[model samples]
Every structure is written in structure tokens, then in C-alpha cells.
Target: MKTDVEELTPTRVKLTVEVPFDELKPNLDKAYKEISQQVRIKGFRPGKVPAPLIDKYVGRGAVLQEAVNDALPELYGRAVEETEIFVLGQPDVEVTELDDGNQFAFTAEVDIRPKFEVPDYDGLEVVVDDAEVTDEQVDETIGNLRERFASLTTAERPVEDGDFATIDLVARIGGEEIEDASTSGYSYEVGSKSAIEGLDDALVGLSAGEEKTFTGTLVGGERAGEEAEITVTVQSVKVKNLPELDDEFAQLASEFDTIDELRDDVRARLGRQVKLQQLSEARDKALEALLEKIDIPLPDKVVEEEISRRNQQLEQQLQMAGMSKEDYLKDEEKSEEEFDKDVADAARLAVKGGFVLDQLAVQEELGVENEELSEYVVTQAMQMGVQPQQLAEYLTQNNQLPAIVSEVLRSKALNLVVEHVTVKDESGNEIDVDAVQRELNGETGETVAADDTDAADEAGVDEADTAEVDTAEAAEAAEPAEAAADAPAATAETAADEAPAAEPKNEGAKDA
Candidate 1:
């Protein structure tokens, strides 16, 4: 076999391949066998038909076509391996020659990774905000803790802010009610603004047994974004009573014996969270700096595909949240043109980042061990709320292990860059990346790690809430991996993330 590569562009190549008849023999034989099993003959069984007889009946051209179709992929792979070119996307293959008994030839035009040298990332500097926990933040955290344990009692007065109200809502368009948008026995918190617009304003100053009509835009359902006249009847109003922040309250709410001790613990927890935010910011800023140091031409096709994918993902999320594109744009304060430009910019950055990291991984000879892959799978499973075995099975069935391995390799490459880079807080204090990593992993003794549910309980937060916060943090930390799982424009990209490990069933709850 002979292979030659022609550079069509810096990011694309055309490969010409020639193979001797012997290399095509195996595929031809296999094709003959397969055709024999499908064709019927008078004296021979299905599997026993001779190649000559079948060829006479089925035609040699058909056999050749079948074999060529089966052989092209392998042939193309061989050509790629021989030329050592990093191809992207699928190749546009055309069989140029088929000299029946002599040789086969074909040409493949495909996009490829542009060859570029990895820039030195040493001494790269990024500035992050100071990890400072303020008194107000601590107070707010403790206040939320108190609210979680607050007792609700029936109130005799009219509805007001912070009051828990039990009400029935009927939504009507042009005086005709929309059943899906109407619900009874609904519990709403006044001033929460979690429901449709104008609900809170109308609910306030209304007493029990009082009904009021207001105009609001529906947030969900098929009639989302449509204006509707909502009639809300308040059935009951309740006042929330928070326990006093004293020794007795501390004992009831947390393991701490005194309010002062509880406050101190809350402050420490806040401090840890602040450090985590700082670290996350630093990682992002460091990546930004690294990207700015390298310039690589991106394949237009890859960037366009990435942009389309991001738009599709965003559309899915907006649909799930019952928001329209216009609503989302309004909320983001961006025009359609601006939103499109942003998506394009983000797509280019993501594509370039993937290319840079992949090259760096190659340059550094980084590899993903089985143990490391297993650990990453487990972490991702936890974040996705699925069992490790189940996620593993899904990945295997989808042939996504290579993408996962690539993701890990890219991560290691980025971590190497981060390690060599200089990160400092606003106050010019040099941050210890290793120490921060340890603390984030729950190795430091200074404060309880984000994953410690027991510590959360001691600090007057529910174990479930703590777990939720930890899961959110983990998800945020794994965004790049998640993006890789969703994207397919890069070497490490996969579309498997679009398929769920398990389909979720709706529990049939009405939206408020």
C-alpha cells in the first residue's frame, strides 16, 4: 500500500491511497461469503454457493462494490495512519481507480488539526479576587439556616411579604380558563417571585377568603409567554416564626452548644466557600491567559458545528425552563445579533482550547491510566445522579471510552499548565495551587470540605442541602469535561452526553 498527503490548507488535507489486489482479497472473500448466505441456488445450500456461480448471477460489479464499501473505512484508516495526519470529521472518499486484478485507488479530502507548536505556559499570571468572607455573607448563611427550621403558624392579618399563603389559581385568556395553567391548593411564598409575573404584587394586601384578579404572563405550559388573567383566592395566610439565635436555638438547630460557636462555624464554612469561588475563578482566568498566549487557525467547519451544538443545547435548556429565545435574550439583556456573535466567539474559543490542550497533551506525553479513567467516570456518575456501573455501561455501549480518555488527558494537560502558572489574589498574595487542590478535595484540616454532610449538619444546614451544594460545585468544576461530552468538534469530543443514562419519569406535579 502507498499513501500520499497533499496539504489543501493548513487545517485540511487530501489523501491519495493505492492498494494492491492482495490487500482487497480478504474483503472480497468476506463479501462473497455474505452474498452466498443471501442468494438462493437450486443444488447448493445458502452457505455453500460457489463464488463463481454467485458472481455470474449477482454480477462482479456488485461484489466489487460491496467489498469496496467494506474496505474503504479500513483503507482510509490505514492511509491516515501511514501519513500520520490528524484528520477531523468524516472524509469525503472517492474511488478513483479499480484495476480489477491489479490495484485499487481512492482519494479522501478531510479537515485536519493545524500543526502548531505549543507555547511555553511557564510564569503565566492570572489575578483572582481575594478569598474574603464578609460578616454580611455569614449572617445571610445563618439566616437561611434559621429560615429552614422556621415554624409556620396561621396569621389573622392580610397577606404580606414573607407570608406563606395557600391559594387557588385560575388562569383565563379572554375569559376562558386554561385548565393546565390553573391549580388549587397551591402553596406560595409572598414576595418570592418564583411564580408568574404580577402574582406577588396581587397577593399582597389580600386576606384569607379574598379573591383578586390580575394580569400576568404565563411562565410555563403550551401557552407560555402568553398573557392571562389570573384569579387567585387566598385560602390561608401563615407567618413564619424563626427561633432566637441563642444557646437553646443553637442546640435545636445544630450540634453547636452556643450561638457564638454556631456563628463561628458558619463563618468558617463561608470562608471555605469563598476560597472555592476564588479557585474556580483563578482556573478560568488562567485558562483565558493560556489561550491568549497561543494563536492557531481554526477550521471553519468545526467552529460552525460547535456553534450549532451550543445553540441546540441552549434551546433544550430554555425549553425545559419554559422560556422562549426572546425571553432568554431579554433576561440576558442581549439582542439576537449580540447573542449570535457571543455564541460564535464562545465556539471559536472552545475549539481552539481543545486543540491547544490536545497538542499540549501530546507534547507532554500525557496519558490516562485505567485507574484515573475509572475515578473520572465515578465522579461524573455522581454528578449525573447515576450509578458508576450504569454510567460505565452507557459509555461502553456508545463507544465513548476514547472520548472520556481524551477528556482526562486534556484535563491533565490543563492542570500541568495551571501548576506552572502564577496565580495571585487581588492583594498580591501568591496562591498555593497544590494546597488549594488539597483543601478542595477535603484533605485540609482547617475547615470542613464542601462534601462533608456531617459537617454541614453541625453547621445547621440539612445534609441534603449540603449534598446538593457539593454536587453543584462538582458539576461546575467538571464543566469542561461535560462540554467535551456534549461537543464533537474536538478530538476529545463526544455526543454521548446527549443520551441520558436513564430516562426520567415525571412525578405529575403541578408547576406554580
Candidate 2:
């Protein structure tokens, strides 16, 4: 057997195989035996008929067809192995030559892995923002917490801001009642902007038992852009009463016994959340900067595949939302051609980014440890409110476990990259890495005692001084995790290629 491969594209190849009569003889003999058992013969017992006798009885054409049918798969398999083609899917084969007592030849076309070099990734310069937690951020979080614990009480005056009012409403278009246009005793908040435009203003001065009417354009309902007459009758008014920010209130609101303790907890939580956001932003900036510096050529087929998948996802989402593809195009202010063009550009960027990251992972020898993957699975299960075993079962059933594991490994690799990079703030100052991490964990000013206002102020100054360093570290920590989450997992074949064949890199594989 002889095999020849032709380059169709960077990621596609066509293999042509030529088999001589010697290689085809075994399959021919097997085919004769199989066909002999299935046919009826007048003078011979079943499975006892000779090939020459059967040929004379069944005709040469019928025997040759059976022989060819049995030989094709073995020929194809040999062609794949001899050519060393890493096929992505099933091959399309066409027989070019098959004559009696002559060479048998066929051509198989397929998509194969492209050969490419990993780009240089070491000592690449990337700048990240400072992950600092601020007092204002803490206050905002505290305010939100207070609102969550606020109580509502009946009010004896006209409706006002933050006041909930129960009312009967009727809407009419062009002096005619529209379908599903009326509701009784619907509760609404004045100045809370909960109702359609002009409705709040229409109810502002109305007391219980008072009725009023207003007109406005429907902003975004089924009747969007249509002018409608709205009549509302105020039935009752209620106002929210927030508890005073006192020690007793703090004890009631949380596990803390004092207002100071609650304030500290809120400040810590806010700081951590802000730190995480800062880290995320810094990582994105670093990645963008790195991508700008590197010019990578991506396969067109990869981009097209990504775009097709994206469009399918978009269509599914639209359908779930009770919208049509045409409706989405209108909402996006685009034609199908325009949408495709935009998606194609995005797909190209996505493919390039994946290639770059994979190269970096390889160059850096970044990998996920088995323990880390197990921890990730546990964390994800907790977030989803399910048992770890249940989550594992679901992933396995869906054939997604390997993909998930790869994602975890990719994240670990990115984090390794971040750890080695230097980070500077906007002011060219170095930041404290540990403090930044704590902030990202949402524990900013919590360590400072409530009475130690001076220490808190000092910490803030230190945070500013060390902003750059922290930003860099946070970027290093966050980039891989975010990238891993966003990236699509490799298929089984790709994952197999990625995994070390001689020595397993992860504990999961070792266990398996």
C-alpha cells in the first residue's frame, strides 16, 4: 500500500492511497468465504462451497463487488495510519481505480491538525491596574445592606418618593380599550420609577380614594412607541421605614453585636468585591496589550466554526426569549449580511486569542494539578447548590468532564503567567501584592479596628503607594481563571493530543 497526502489548507489535508493486488488478496479471500455461506448451492453443503465453484455459480461481478466492499474499510484504515493524518472527522472517500488483476486506488479528503510553532511568551511586558478598596465603595455596600433590612409601614398622606401605592389602572389606545389593559389594586412605588413614564408623576399628589388620568408613550412593552391614555385610582399608600444605624440595629441585622462590627464586615466584603473587579479589569488589559503585540495567523475554518456556533447560540437565546431571528436583526439595527460580517470579525479575534493562549500555556509549561481540579469541582458544586458527586455525574453523562478539566488546567496556566509579571500603578508606584489579594477577596479595611480611624487612613495611603504591584499580581492571579471559563474545551481527540501520552501531567489522569 502506498499513501500520498496533499495540503488543502493549514488545517485540512487529502490522502490518496494506492493498494496493489497482494494487499487486497486477504480481504478477497475473507469476502468469498462470507458470501459462500450466505448463498444457496444445489450440489454442496452450507459453508463447504469452494471459491471457484461459488464464482461459477454466482457470477464474477457479484463476487468482485463483495470483495471490494470488504476491502474498503481496511484500505482506508491503512491509509490513515500510513499517512499519519490527525483527522478531525470522518473522511470522504472516492474510488478512482479498481480493475480486475490491477491496482486498487482511492482518495480520502479530511480536515487535519495544522503544524505551527508556539510564539515567544517569556518576559512579555503587561500593565495592570491597582486593586484598591475604597471607603466610598464600602459605604455603598453598607447602604445596600441597610435597604435589604428596611421595613414598610402604612402612610396617611399623599404618595411620595419611596412610598408604595395601591391603585386601579386602565390603559386605552386611540380612545379604545386594548386587550389586557386593566389591573385592580396593583401596588406601585412613586419616584421609584417602577411604572411606565408619566405614571409616577400622575400619582404623586393623589391620596387614598382619589382618581386621576394621564397619557404617555409606551416605552418597551408589546405596545412600544404607541401613545396611550392611563387612568389610575389611588387606594392606599405605604412608606418604607429604615432602622436607625445603631448598635441594637446592627445586632438585629447580623451576627455582629455592635454597629462597628457590622461596618467592618461590610467594608471588608466591599473591598474584596472591588479587588476582584480590579483584578479582572487588569487581566483584561494585560491580555489586550499582549494580543496587540503579537501577530498570530488563525485558521479560517476555526473562525467559521466559531461563528457558526455563536449564531446557533444567538438563535437559541432569541427563541427562548420569544423572539424571531428577524426581530433580533431589527433590534441590533442590522441586516443578516451586517450581522454575519460582525460575527466573522469577532470569530477571527476569538480564534487568534485561543492560539496565543495555547502557545503561552505550552511555553510556560502551565498546567492544572489534580487537587486543584478537585477543589474547583467542589467549589463549582457549592455555587450551583448541588453535591459534588451529582455535579460529576452530570458532567460525565454529558461527556463534558474532560473539557471541564482542561478548562481548569488552562486557568492554572494563566495564573502562573501572572505570578511572574511585574505590576505598576498609574502613578508608577509599586503596590503591596498581599493587600491587593485581600482586597480582591473583599477584606479591605476590615482588619483596622473601628476606633483606629488613623490606621485606616494610613492603610489607604499605603494601598495607593502599592497599587501598581497589587494590580500586577491580581492580573496574574485572575487572567488564567477568566480565560479558562471563557474558552471552549477541546474535543476528545484534541484533548488526547494535548495530554502527555508517555507521562500523565494531572492527578485525575493518574487515578483514571
Candidate 3:
């Protein structure tokens, strides 16, 4: 067999392969054997029919076609191996020649990963905001904790913001009621504005048993976005009573014996959260800097596909939220043209970033270990609210394992880049990204005091910190893959030859 490659473009190639009759014998024999089991000869048992006899019965052209169909995938793969081109998507294949007993030839044109230099990523610099925890932030965190343990009491007064009001509400169009939009005895915060429009404003200044009717638009249901008459009758108004911030309050809310200890724990937790946020920002800025330094040409087809996918996903989410594109654009304050351009730009960046990181992974000899993959799967399952085994089974059954591997490899490559790059805070102070990561992972020599351990844990630091860290880690780990999710399927195992399937051996034979 002989194979030749033609450079159609830097990102694409055309391969022409020629094979002599001798190399075609194996596929021909297999095709004949397969055909024998399907066709019944008058005197011979199934699988015992001679090839020549079957050829006489089922034309040699049909047999040759069958053999060629069976051989093309393997032959194409061999040509690819010999040429050693980084093919991207599936190839466009055509059988160019078939000299009955002498030679066979075909051509395949495919997109490929363009060859480019991955520049030195070390010394790349980016600036992130300082991870400084302020007293106000700590107070706010503690205040939220206090609110969690607050008590409710009936107040004989008008409804007001920050007060929980128990109300009965009804919605009607021209005095005809909309059942789904109406509820009885629902409790809502006056300032939350989470319910229908005009509901919050109407609730204020209303006492118990006092009712007022206002016009508001229905946000969901068959009459969504349509205006209707809303009547809200307040059953009662209750004010939240927060416990006094004292040693007794600390003991009641947490295991801490004093308010000072509780405040200290809150400050420390806020500090960790801020640092994690800083790390996340740094990853984004570092990646942006790296991309700016590199030049990579994205395939137009991949970009277009990604844009379409993103649009489809957005449309699905908006549909589930009962919103139209016009409503979404209005809410986002973007015109259709601007939104379209944004989608296209984002798609191109996603494609280019995938390509760059992929090359970087190769250059750095990065590999994904089983443990790493398992951790990734588990983390993703947690975010998706599914069991790890169920998610793994779904991914495996859908042939998505390669995509997952690619994602992990890209994540490792990004991490390597982040480690090498110089990241500083906005105040020009050089920040230690590694130290922050260690602290988040609880690897630092900092341990909760034995007596304060349960108190601190009960104060909500460990749980909230764990959740925040998992979120940050998941976002950083999955960002690349999520961005490139719609890029061309580039894994070798999934690069199907796209050759045509075999034809029926004969008219009277079962389909092969």
C-alpha cells in the first residue's frame, strides 16, 4: 500500500491512498466468509459454500464492493498513522479508483490541529484584587448567622420592609381568576420582591385584614407577561427579633462561650472565602494574559457550531424560565445584533483557548491520572446533584469519556501555567497563589482550637468554606471543557473513518 498527503491548508489535509490487490485479499476473504453464512446454496450447508460458487451466484462486483467497504476504515487509519497528521473531525472519504484485480485507491480530506509554537508561558503576569477581609464583612457574616437563629413575634402594626407578612393573594384578568398565579395564606418578605410585581409595594402600610388591589404582570403561567389585577389581604405582620450579641447569644447560636470568639471565627472564615475568590480571579486573569500572548487560528466550522450550541442552550434555559428572547434582551439591556456578536466572539475565544491549552498539555507532557479523573467525576456529580456512579455510567455510555479526559488534561495545563505565572494584587503586592490554595485545602499548619473546634464548626465556617472551595475548584477545573464542549471531537479513538457500510451480498441473501 502507498499513501500520500497533500496540504490543503495549515489546519486541513487531503490524503490519497493506493492499495494493490494483494493487501485487499484479507478483507475480501472475510467479506466472502461473512457472505457465505447469509446465502444458502442448494447442496451446501450454510458457511460451507465456495467463494467462487458464491461469486458466480452473487456477482464479483458485489463481492468486491463488500471487501472494499470492509477494508476502507482500516486502510484510512493506517494512512493516517503513516502520515502522522493531527486529524480533528471525521474525514470526507471518496473511493477514487478500483481496478478489479490490480489496484484500489481513495482520498480523504480532513480538518486538523494546526501546528503552532506554544510560547514560553512562564513569567506571564496578571493582577488580582487583594484578598482583604474587612470588619464590615465579618460583621455582615455574623449578622447573617444571627438572623438564622432569630425569633419571630406578632406585631400589631402596619406591614413594613424586613417584616414577614402572612397574606392571602388572588390574581384575576377582567375579574376572572388565574388559579396558578393565586395562592392563599402564603408568607413573604415585604422587601424580597420575589413574588409577582407590585406585590411588595402593595403590602407595605397595610394592617391585618386590610386589602388592596393593584395591577401587576404575571411572570409565569399561560398568561405570563400579561397584566392582571392582584388583590393581597394581609393576615398578620411579624417582625424578626434578633438575639442580643452577647456571651449568651454566642452560646445559643454556636458552641462558642463568648461573642468575641464567635467574631474571630467569622473573620477567619471571611478571610478564607476572600482568598478563594482571589484565586478564582487570578486563574481567569492569568488565562486571559496567556491567550493574549499567543496567536492561534480557530476553525470557522468549530466556532460556528459552538455559537449555535451556546445559543441553543440559552434558548432552552430561557424557555424553562418562561422568558422570550425579547424579554431576556430587555432584561440584559442588549440589542439583538450586540447579543449575536457577543455569542460569536465568545465562541471563537472558547475554540482558540481549547486549542492553545491542548498544545500546552502536549508540550508539558501533562497526563491525567485515574485518581484525578475520579476526583473530577465526583466533583462534577456533586455540582450536578447526582450520584457519582450514575454520572460516570451516563458519561461512559454516551462515549463522552474522551471529552472528560481532554477536560482534565486542559485543567492540568492551566494549573501549570498558573503556577509559573507571576500574580500580584492590585496594590502591586506579590501574592502567593500556592499558599492560598494550601490554606483552602486545609494543608496549612492552622488548626481550630480543640475547645473552639466544635464551636467554629457550628459557627458555619467549615461547611461554608468547604462548599465555597468545591465551587471554586469545580469552576476552575471545568471551565476549559465547558467552553470547548462544542469544539470538534478531536480524540483519536472517536475519529471514525466515515467510510460507507457494506452492501447486501446478494438480492436473496440476508442483509450484511
How many clashes (backbone N, Cα, C below 3 Å) per candidate?
0, 9, 0
Q: All candidates' lDDT scores?
A: 0.76, 0.62, 0.74
Can you give the TM-score per candidate against the true fold? 0.84, 0.67, 0.79
Per-residue lDDT of candidate 3, residues 1-512 (tens digit): 89999988877789999999889999999988988999988999999889999899987888899999999999988997788676666689999999988999999998777778689988899998888999889888888777667766789999988788889988999889999889888877778777788898999999999999999999878898899999999998888777799999899888899999999978877776667667767766777788899876666667677777778778777776656788778877989998898778777776677787787877876766666666666656555666676777787677566677777677677778789989999999998887767665573333321112222232222332322112233333542323234334332211112222223211221111
Pairs that collide in candidate 2 are 268-442, 272-441, 272-442, 418-476, 424-468, 425-468, 430-466, 431-466, 431-469
Worst 10 residues of 1 by lDDT: 493-502
* Local distance difference test, candidate 2: 0.62
lDDT of 1 by residue, 41-67 (tens): 999999899999987999999999999
List candidate 1 segments past 4 Å from native: 442-512
Better of 1 and 2 by lDDT: 1
Highest lDDT model number: 1
Best by TM-score: 1
| RMSD (CA, angstroms), candidate 3 | 12.7
Model 1: lDDT of residue 409 = 71
